[model samples]
Target: MLDKLAKAGDIIAADAVTRAIAKLSETPVPAGVHVEATEGGVLLSGRHLRRRMLGDPQLRNFGK
Candidate 1:
């Protein structure tokens, strides 16, 4: 029983780690956002930066 419990705990921990990795691997910014490497750090800007960042629904028809 103890061994089975440990195995289940290990599986749960591994699954948590995998989910964390997947979340971290995702891009923070949405597509169409410009990324610039500046001397200070990084700067993000674009024509639709505000809309994209805010997840505007109408963005689906952008540039159409």
Candidate 2:
């Protein structure tokens, strides 16, 4: 499902998924969930989220 969507090579669709994830993780995130997406070939990250005061461009893979 998600894998196919990601591998579809459609940046628009992939960005949609990334944005959705950003919206969903705004608080104490739900557990027992797995989010897997291959390297954003075209669409970078929209997570735009900061952790511990550091922003997105840090040396980290936020989704991991």
User: Which candidate comes out best when scored by lDDT?
Assistant: 1
Q: Single out the weakest 10-residue window by summed lDDT for candidate 1.
A: 55-64
Model 2, residue 22: displacement in angstroms? Answer: 0.4
Model 2 off-target regions past 4 Å?
1-9, 27-64
Taking all chains together, each candidate's TM-score versus the true structure is 0.42, 0.29
Clashing pairs in 1: none
Tens digits of per-residue lDDT for model 1, 1-64: 6999999999998777666555433425456665554443345667867667557553433322
Q: CA lDDT of 41 in candidate 2? A: 24
- What lDDT, from 0 to 1, does candidate 2 have? 0.45
Candidate 1 global TM-score: 0.42
| Clash pairs detected, candidate 2 | none
Candidate lDDT (C-alpha), each: 0.58, 0.45
Q: Lowest-lDDT window of 10 residues in candidate 2?
A: 41-50
Model 2 lDDT per residue over 1-64, tens place:
6987777768887788777666444423223323343454222333432342263233144344
